[model samples]
Target: MNTFEKAAHFALTAHEGQIRKANPIPFILHPMEVAQIVSTMTHSQEVMAAAVLHDVVEDTSVTLEEVRETFGDRVAWLVEKETENKRHNLPAADTWQIRKEESLLDLKNCDDKDVQILWMADKLSNLRSFFRSRLRDGDRMWELFNQKDPEKQKWYYSKILELCDQLQDTTAYREYKILLKAIFSTDAINLQYQTGAFHFEV
Candidate 1:
């Protein structure tokens, strides 16, 4: 099988019985789409594999060691770095702070162009996703930050804009920005459960 196919199998088996807390979409699809999106930016097998197993540690019982044993050490390391700790029950602000720190650290260490491309692609995806979800219910999305929750909104967009500046490739950054802006005009490309996601005037 090709890279994408291999990645699909790896992610599917890893997330075999998991579901997204945000909704139900056979959790494997999330990583697969991330991997695919990253692939469009770089042909690096490492980044693609990282995208495939991105949530394995956080979403399933799978361990980093297990991923290394099955895929490879490099792939496992990237996956580990990108994994989110949603399992924690920290106060809202604390959790968001930790997550933000983790991502910023990892991105700072991303000297490799391929890695930066993947990271930027991931952030771009998140920004576009939230924008649509916001348009669907602006009040709820806006109110989410009333308690000063960093992850509530906008912070992600701001950080992503920063990451985009960190990107060494101008062309890639511009294209990604165009897509990020286009999200306001186009339908929520990746969202499934959220309807009226494009309520924001184009």
Candidate 2:
């Protein structure tokens, strides 16, 4: 099989029956969409492959060494850097600032543009989740977001900016940065981007 076929099969089998944290949507949708997003870029096969397998090492029983053996060292390394040990993920009450810092540090030391693409794609999934949550719970979530009582929305929204700041890709980051600005400026705009109602600025 070709690399793409191998990667797809690997991810599908690895993530079988899994779902997103707050949604019933299959978890594979994220990686699949992210890979699709990077397909708009050149020389991006590994970025696409890495996106499909991005969570395998971190969120699954899979290991980096095994991925290396399967997909080769480069793809394995991207997964390694992108996978954060949950000793790193914060509780909702804890500020996402710490998680943001870790990602920044990781981005700073990272030499691979491939990892950066994976990081941006990961945040794209995150922003998409915000829209999904808002839809499920309604503007009451927005009211709570404005009140900052529960702190979940604050953490999630700040992440959009933090991840945007960490992105070093001039072109893709610019595109996503525009999306972030639009998302923050108006709820209508946020929903527009989230629902594919708006086109990404070329």
Candidate 3:
């Protein structure tokens, strides 16, 4: 198997029986989409591999050392960077904002273009999923997240958008902008999801 195939298999196995919180779909699809998005940026096997394995250590029983041993040091490091820092023994509800804020700060100060591209790919894929789901379910979609407040979610995404804007030249970053603008419009006050009428340009 190629590097990406190997990583994909590992991620699929790690996430087996898991489903998307918003919808009852296989969790492996998220990593596959992430890998595809990163592929649009570069053909680097390590980046694609890392994208596929990004959530494994964060969301599954898989350990970072296992990823490092299986994928190598570089891919493992990229996965670590993509993984959210959840504090040990702390409730996610209590630390959600703090963890997100830390991620934003890390991205802001980050200088590595490859890492930036990988990060953009991940966010863009997530935004694409949100756009599709919102089109189908409207505001009720917010019920799926740990943080259910639409305003708070919008704030977090906006901050991430600004950090991503620095890499605006890339296609993935441009798509990220489009998704944000389409979903977080002023009409949000109407309690109606308007983006459904318009196709996601991403």
- The candidate that wins on lDDT is 3
| Candidate 3 lDDT by residue in tens digits, 40-147 | 888999999999999999999999999999989999989988888888699887898999988888888887776787788887877888877777788788888888
Give the range of the ten consecutive residues with the poorest summed lDDT in model 1: 192-201
TM-score of each: 0.71, 0.72, 0.90
Which lDDT tens digits does candidate 1 get at residues 78-132? 7776776663666655576667667777766666565566666666555555555
Error of 1 at 61 (Å): 1.0
Predictions: Cα RMSD each: 5.5, 5.2, 2.6
Question: What is the lDDT, from 0 to 100, of the residue 58 in candidate 1?
Answer: 74
Reference-based lDDT, residue 102, model 1: 74
| Global local distance difference test of model 1 | 0.62
lDDT (C-alpha) at residue 92 in model 1: 55
Clashes of each: 0, 0, 0
Better of 1 and 2 by TM-score: 2
